[model samples]
Target: MLASVTGKGVCLCTILWILDTKGVFSLKNVTLSIEPSVVQYRNTSKLRCTYDLEGDALYTVKWYRGSLEFYRYTPSEKERDKRKQAFPFKGVTIDVDRSDSTQVTLNDIDFVVSGEFCCEVTTEDSHIHALNNCKSMVVVQLPEHPPEISVRGEPFDYGDILRANCSSYRSRPPADLTLILNGITVNQTEPLALRKLRPTDYSDLQLELKLSDLHFQEGQLNLQCVAQVSSVYHETVGLELQSVRHPVPEKVSAPNTASAASTASSQTIPLRLFCFTMLCFNAESVIKILIKTIPASCVTYYTVVATPVCDYTDIRINSLDKFYALIVVINLINIKMPHNDNPK
Candidate 1:
């Protein structure tokens, strides 16, 4: 009879195992969702738990912050008031009216609330089945203002060294800092500097960028500093640097003496003097006298006199005395004109 009872018990256990393998009265796809996994202090956050109970009824759903239980939902409770209950836990504020079997709402969260959140679900069956899921949440105190960027070695120039520092004030998790030059990220080889302030848990972060042989585009360089705290807060500040250099002087050249003499000699006498000479002498006789008295190099003045008057005039010589007088005047004027001493 004992062997027969043992065989029956083994058969019952086998049947339960087969039922579980077929997903009958079992939990599947248990998930925990936390909105704003990284949350700012004094803000609200939501936590949701979801599960599929195949061919089973939910007995209880419980919420825990770390290992401490703060909320429970029992749909099978006979008293309607007892169906949802909240227990006290430090740093956990539950809005009971807005919470249900699948989700819980947290209000006015602070840094103390940062920890692992867990959800547990149990099935109502003679053979009880339970499932739980946990996820991490962080509550941070954000910096009050954006990051500040300070640059040293102003008036940058090519082949010069440039140094800059980016700083972010007190924050729960110190902000990450990056330096960008003209849309390209500049890697920081040095370790970041961290400082902790008194009377608070918040800390400060600072990064430095020291670049040599600085290059600029279009006579200017653009530098930016970005600070970020998780996914909740981000800020960027930028500055432009202009290159400076000294002015250059221009060269001056001396005047050419030969060119000045040539210009002065080419100056022509007045037309009235030509008209007066033409009235005193015939064109052919004046040409003969000019060729004999003046050098061949000075024939340009003869051409100037003959061109306008002799080409169109039929005037007859009235006096030889006036002709001789005009020749004397021409010789005296030619002597007064400037000439180059050194001929090339």
Candidate 2:
């Protein structure tokens, strides 16, 4: 009886050890990796599942998109053609040629595919060990063009108010918009506005800046608008601001009455001429006086008189009365009577 009991106990311990070993070698470290977590619409993506099954064989590798099974891989299938399979699902197209138990290729993904994706693995063990991992993906419909920035109150002047607006349109998931002024971000005091159309969305942001001396300290203000959709898309538009300042008025002194009168008299004088003859007169002296007092256009002709004892000249003067008075004084001082050998 003692021998039989001891043998049975040994067998029981062996069975327990085998069970513990099997449990220890079950599935572990199951991880799911989805490339390009942010995917553009109608683009391809790849998902991979990695697991350490110890010494167990892979029973099935199944992929789920939000609780719906779309792909399955079973190595234990008797028929080779039935081992890998794909199910029809909206927005999910599997590339069967490049898919296997470890990884799956997704083609032509769209907005409907943006959600949690799970990978489940089961081992061919008596205990049917299973494990699953899930990750998220986002599909975005990018805008055809970058965000547009516009200013309402342009040609800004000091102490004026400036208004600006930024717009991003036609995106499935609306892009975020930011307004920056001179490299500094401008806070959005106004509420953001959204307009949704079929298959796309639009976003708009407004900003207001008060023009002051501080804003124009650097001579010009720089404004920018940035649009972003996660890490997939980014665009920027910028504008420059300058303030217009009016020029200061200059001072003017009162006019001089005496100078004004003199200028008026000179301009209003009537032009005229007078002829004079003198004895023992210098012809060159008379000619010089006439040229200074008369304009060249008014003078018709001039005659110089030469005598045995004196020289004289006939001069025509076309000038103001002040100039004629000056000529009479010169004649009195420069003329010398031909020494009257005969007294008259």
Candidate 3:
């Protein structure tokens, strides 16, 4: 009887000792990395989360967003209840395998699934325990709109110089812009290569098409341009170019009081003086006076007013507003003509 009682006492003591000396197991070297940080529209991306642990201790795993629960797994039961109970996790999936350490695979991410995540694993050895580890999942969204084009220029009336611009302000990658003028790609994408053909904005994927050669046929010239953009989001978009109507330059026969400004370049200032000397001898003094006074302004404005001498002359160029550089040069030539030398 005494031997039996001693055996029972030893068994009880062993149970207590086992409970007091629990082993401490920890999940160390935990890592999570996604294959692509940027996800394209309607695409699949892989995500891997893994860790090394001391033993095959049953872990109670749970994924959380702030205070809300994302997913949960108990290694002892080792069952996955696939559910996206959280705000954006409803479409996501998880794969867990404890044999090769715990790994969770998340799939089908959208713009809303981007946020911070923590993987919780509980482990214990014959000593202590551990709690939580955090990582990040980032999902990039695709571009929705193509590059928009805005065309600027004086529209209506023939010879109204127009400005055209194509800007892809909302795209991740810059756009490849093309200019289609009157059924022809008139401008090639080259540096300073015969660009006088049309108006183009080098800074913007835009253009400034001049109505120099195009006339108001039938009614008005139909001008159109388009901008194309391919984005990192694996999407390509083409925007309709803006169209503007500019009028054909008017036939001039009216007289004006303001002194006419010459569109002649500074380099041609000397040539103009020689022409003025000839006009004084052959043409009316009013025409000669105009040649002297019509500096720093457009010749078109002056010729319309300087007597009806050259009524049929049609060497029409765009008014001084087309080029800023030309405006300064043509307006600041400082031609020196004295009123005393007017044609007598």
**Span of ten consecutive residues with least summed lDDT in model 1:** 328-337
- Sorted by lDDT, highest first, which candidate order results? 2, 1, 3
In model 3, how many backbone clashes occur? 32
Rank the candidate models, highest TM-score first.
Answer: 2, 1, 3
Candidate 2 achieves a global lDDT of 0.74
Off by over 4 Å in 2: 1-17, 188-199, 245-344
> For model 2, what is the error of residue 246's alpha carbon versus the real structure, in angstroms, after optimal superposition?
13
Return the top candidate by TM-score.
2
Give the per-residue lDDT of model 3 (tens digit) for 44-146.
5544456666564645555654555656655455333332121335546443332123444556655555666676656645544556666565554323455
Local error of candidate 3 at residue 310 (angstroms): 55
**Greater-TM-score candidate between 1 and 2:** 2
Q: How does residue 185 of candidate 1 score in lDDT?
A: 77
RMSD of each: 20.1, 19.6, 20.9
Query: lDDT tens digits, residues 1-344, model 2?
Result: 99999999999999989986876456899999999888989999999999998888789999999989999999988775689999987986899889999999999997899999999999876778789999999998898998888887666777788798999877867777888877778843232243334456787889777877666635676788888877888899887754455332467889999678656554222334343434333566555555566555323322233321122344433434543432322321222222334544
Per-candidate clashes come to 0, 0, 32
Better of 1 and 3 by TM-score: 1
Clash count, candidate 1: 0
lDDT of each: 0.70, 0.74, 0.46
